[model samples]
Target: MNIAQLSGRGVEITDPLREYVDEKLSRLDRFHDQITSARVTLTVRDVKNAARRNRVEVQINVPNGIIRAEESNADMYAAIDKASDVLERQLRKFKTKFLKQRHEAQPQPEPGPAEQAAQLGEEDGEVQPEIVRQKRFELRPMTPQDAVFQMEALGHDFYVFKNMGTDSCGVVYRRKDGHYGLIEPK
Candidate 1:
């Protein structure tokens, strides 16, 4: 397993704390051996309220995609524990989905038309409903701030727009904390 990069914001990282984080994250290798890299950030928010002051965020890069988990608590150690638990659950889910997709992608014997249709409607042993509606819109070029404004005007949680700076597709969304987040291609 690759050693994770650990950083702190508004707090000093001690040797014991670093060792604890390394020991906790190392166990993730049992779930997926292909974890390319991991980044862990510990933050201590300077807020008046002491509850949920410490935050732990972990981002793991794998072959298929990235898995992330964030948790906050009054104690940094508790926050780290919660974040690791969330990561474990997400890694298990990702592994199961990857295995299922690999199994489904294998060559199969030709089936009758009805059987093919049935198979198309069922994936992972669950029936999938067809699309009932569709919408088309122009992706106007705008800055992330403008996209966030447009999303709020349209009463949408997310909006896809062409980024003015990068000249590429981007997404702006409202986070649960009433802040905005932007997503762009690497």
Candidate 2:
């Protein structure tokens, strides 16, 4: 597997720095060999408060999908280590889950498109209705001011609620530029 490390936000990027990152991320393949490549990015925050805001983000590419993990620390090396650790665990979890699902399906040998289509047509003779397997409980009657507070508390881009005074289903969402948008039933 190949590992590429890149530094952004005017940070110094050198071969030795990237080599260090590659060595840390390469350890993940010890647990899950299916990883094809990893891309790590380092960026320094422009905030004036503290150096802790510097961040490291890592992305691992697998056959099925990509996995991303990130962490911010006072030092760039610490941030990279923390993010790499999280990525390793996530890779193991995904690999185990995918193998278990494949084993349960007992899929047959690969076949040509014609044979596959015939099998699919036969299987489609039986129809099954889908059911809602999960239900999410969200929000409560509150003033718009309070609803906005709740939305930020949940760290979500949007929130749903019954406006206390209006007694109607409403939504408050965060915009890309840190603005709030309200949706009220007409």
Candidate 3:
């Protein structure tokens, strides 16, 4: 377990509030033991609207990925509780997903050249300066429409696929304007 960093936008982080948040988030370690660190941010937004002014956001760093949860409520304590609940739910879901991925059957892409290079680098203990993380999966062929559906279904901001019609690599991404954009190799 780690102490959460307490920060406030318009409100002061009193000792009691800090202790409360730390106590609440410490329970998360029970859900996911691999959590390395956690950062919490508390904000008082819209001072006039006390009904939904208190906002709490928590970010946890784990070995595989980072988990984040945010909640807003009338009271700071309530917000903290809600955020912790959300994080617990997310952590549980992540655990379920990895366990399922291990036993369940799913389509997977073959290793590409990049994966080969990464494997070689690991074998040789040579550091690759540019690449921080590398993920290898089968590039399934799909249409732009299908890519958009897949991206939304996965709850990701972007998705990459092999364009079936164009026979090129393409990316479909959610845009800031609540729209989808497609990028294809020219």
Which candidate number maximizes lDDT?
A: 1
TM-score of each: 0.57, 0.54, 0.58
Cα lDDT tens digits for candidate 1, 77-182: 9888998888888788778766775777443322222112232234664667689999775677666655665565445787888777678877777765787666
Query: How much is the lDDT of residue 182 in candidate 2?
Result: 69
Candidate no. 3 TM-score: 0.58
- Please give the lDDT score at residue 1 for candidate 2: 52
Instruction: TM-score for candidate 2, please give it.
Output: 0.54
Please state the error at residue 99 of candidate 1 in Å: 0.6
Model 3, 102-179: lDDT tens per residue?
586653432222212222224445755677789775577766665665565345887888877677787777766788
lDDT of 2: 0.67
C-alpha local distance difference test of each model: 0.74, 0.67, 0.72
Ranked candidates, highest lDDT first: 1, 3, 2
Runs in model 1 deviating more than 4 A are 106-186
User: Arrange candidates by TM-score, highest first: which order?
Assistant: 3, 1, 2
